[model samples]
Target: MHRRRRTAVVVTSALLLSVPLLAACGNEARPGAAAVVGGERIEVGAVQSKVKAVRVAQERSPQAEQLVKDSGQLTRAKLYDLIVARVVEKAAEDAGVSVTRKEVQTGRAQLVGQAGGEEQLAAMYLQQRGIAPGQLEDVVRRDVLVGKLAEAIGATNGQEGQQKLNAAFSAAAATLDIDVNPRFGTWSDQDLALGEYKAPWITQVTQSQGAPVSGA
Candidate 1:
């Protein structure tokens, strides 16, 4: 039997909290920022700090070290995240889905509640993870905006519009042409052949194992 190993690109909640770090690192060393996205400048310090935080969290896992060693995989994943964020932000702006301060506060409260109450969750997230209180609100607000934009783009489910929404999403994904860098984690031609041809699960697994994990 072929077993397909799902290669999950793990981005933690802590990274979401460290978005400000993206601007801080950049402005510290030089006069200007490192990267700009959707007219917003990204700070090198912020990106570095966020990456460091992610590494710190991953240190607990054996896979973390190996993943770090894979520089291509790391870079590709980071770029992918940035691109997605920019795309979502642009889409939200186009749709005029504004994220407000009040909405952010509400979202933060809801998150805290979901994490099992404010005090305990705050201590764990703020004290332990070094995430500022305001950062939580920003993350929540961004997520809300993204959701609203997705709904506007017909990416949400409704009884009457389910099929239409599905078709729209499919067309959008096709148009996006999201090509994964082969040096990073990507499905190979062999893997695609197996998956597309509807080969037995076991056959797909065996074929995938023989294929190279990293590209040239």
Candidate 2:
């Protein structure tokens, strides 16, 4: 009886010691399972997946497709959007701005309007964007809360407010230290045939035509 009791005690102690090691191993196995922002752990995979989905949507656009082919702007834009969203979310939390169901409903209504109505919007988002009707409400709620927090941080209706907001945005953008992967995001208009061109012969041609040149 004494030997059995001692053996049980030893086994219990061993199991207790293994628990922490097991937990550490589990965490190591899932590298991106959690995202640590300001010491808070949010689900990293969830946010990353959402960002990818948005990128996929942008990829479907003709201009976006061409841009992505020349420069990886799609991925960079997605990263930028996520970083900005996370910052805005943090700001909202700091400002104590809360999103309510009613506010989410209002946001959903606005999105529906942009989508051209509830039925059509639902089909379009579901089929093309792979976003469910319910999920859109959550997205809208977060956006609305962020907007409200921004307004609160920099009041909504004055020149001072506008300046404050611009300053705040600039500061936020600076702090993000976004390192855009050039292969995915950098492209010159010359490479894409999208910017203006100087025509040296045009000036002489117009002069020969006797066209009135203002201030000439």
Candidate 3:
């Protein structure tokens, strides 16, 4: 009878020790993933690579210290951009919107003209948007795609149109089933945002062009 009691106590200790281990396993759904969107992993290495590119560009800029200081949340920002890129792609696909190579080139040219030169354009984006020079083309393409997607959905030139645009993006985001790693931040479908950073270029470009969400 004394031996039987010892065995029961041993079994209970083993079960108690496993509780924490099981909880840890539950938290790591995909090891080394920053997030999982549409059942695909956004690996930590991919996010770090983009962040490294931005840092490299910033280091070469005249406002290197200020740029780096301002983007202290650079990891989260880059991750946000990565997640939004996928969201924009899905939204555009659903809206039957497509951006061509010529459109991207034209968009870049227009921006360059506005900023005075290609170097100035790079500086402007890096300083204002935390976007690296190497990532500029992707940014331009996404911007153009957003514009086309807005038009395709008949997102008119006002608040109503803005609401439509948000709806389209929100729907796409919801379908993606975005799951962000706790170390970064959370995802919000309704806001079409990652944590506090809402969609940037979309709102900025729309408001600047005076085409949609004028007050926004």
Candidate 4:
């Protein structure tokens, strides 16, 4: 139980913040940083592109209405999530955590079996989660990496190595000098996650964050 909490805080939430010692990345005043993890710039444009691809995939699929309906929330959260994903990558590298392509393939197969088959897994990811089939494998690979990281940090079936792992994650995030554009939200020290903050006018009414490309 404690191990799960620790790993969830350190690696599982992957972006989920935990542990009380995280110092919010103080790079807000720095411009052009959609997010900066360990001083590496994750340009706003990169986030925008990823969102574009997701939107494109959504538009082409039959789930257009739900995709459009959740665009605002999805775009924002997914952007933040990707930024956190970068942070996770750096932390994993530092901890020597890794996964092979075969591992990812095997994991996906196992998940497919649990869901009854590939078609079913695709439905859950696409229809339910709004993630495209093309991106499903990427999602599975990330989970595999997160699990390896947890294992490396000592989050096993039953163990007490979470605090140390949390410390490591905090150190990595802090040192990376993370900063988010104010247009998105503030970085939360408590949750070790990005908290969305939008302009009053924008928040006054719910609206689409971005529209599908004219041709796309």
Identify the candidate with maximal lDDT. Answer: 3
Once fitted onto the true fold, the runs of candidate 4 whose alpha carbons sit more than 4 angstroms away are: 1-32, 127-130, 157-167, 196-216
TM-score rank order? 3, 4, 2, 1
User: Which candidate leads the pack in TM-score?
Assistant: 3
> Candidate 1 residues 143-176, lDDT tens each?
5564444456554433333343334323333343
TM-score of predicted structure 2: 0.44
lDDT of 4 by residue, 1-216 (tens): 222212212112112222221123234565555666666776666666666666787787676777666555554555565655665677789989887898778667666776777777776665544455766776666655655676677644332444444455566667667676555566653245566332110000111222110100
- Candidate 2 at residue 99, lDDT? 68
Candidate 2 segments whose C-alpha is farther than 4 A from its true place = 1-36, 40-48, 51-71, 118-138, 166-216
Q: What's model 1's lDDT at 190?
A: 25
**In model 1, which range of ten residues has the least summed lDDT?**
198-207
Instruction: For candidate 3, list the clashing residue pairs, or say none.
Output: none
lDDT of 2 by residue, 1-216 (tens): 121111100000000010010111124533543323334333444545654564464466444554334323322322333444555565556567776787667556655665678776654543433343544554455445544654567434445644554455444434443332222232121121101211110011111221211110
Give TM per candidate.
Answer: 0.43, 0.44, 0.79, 0.66
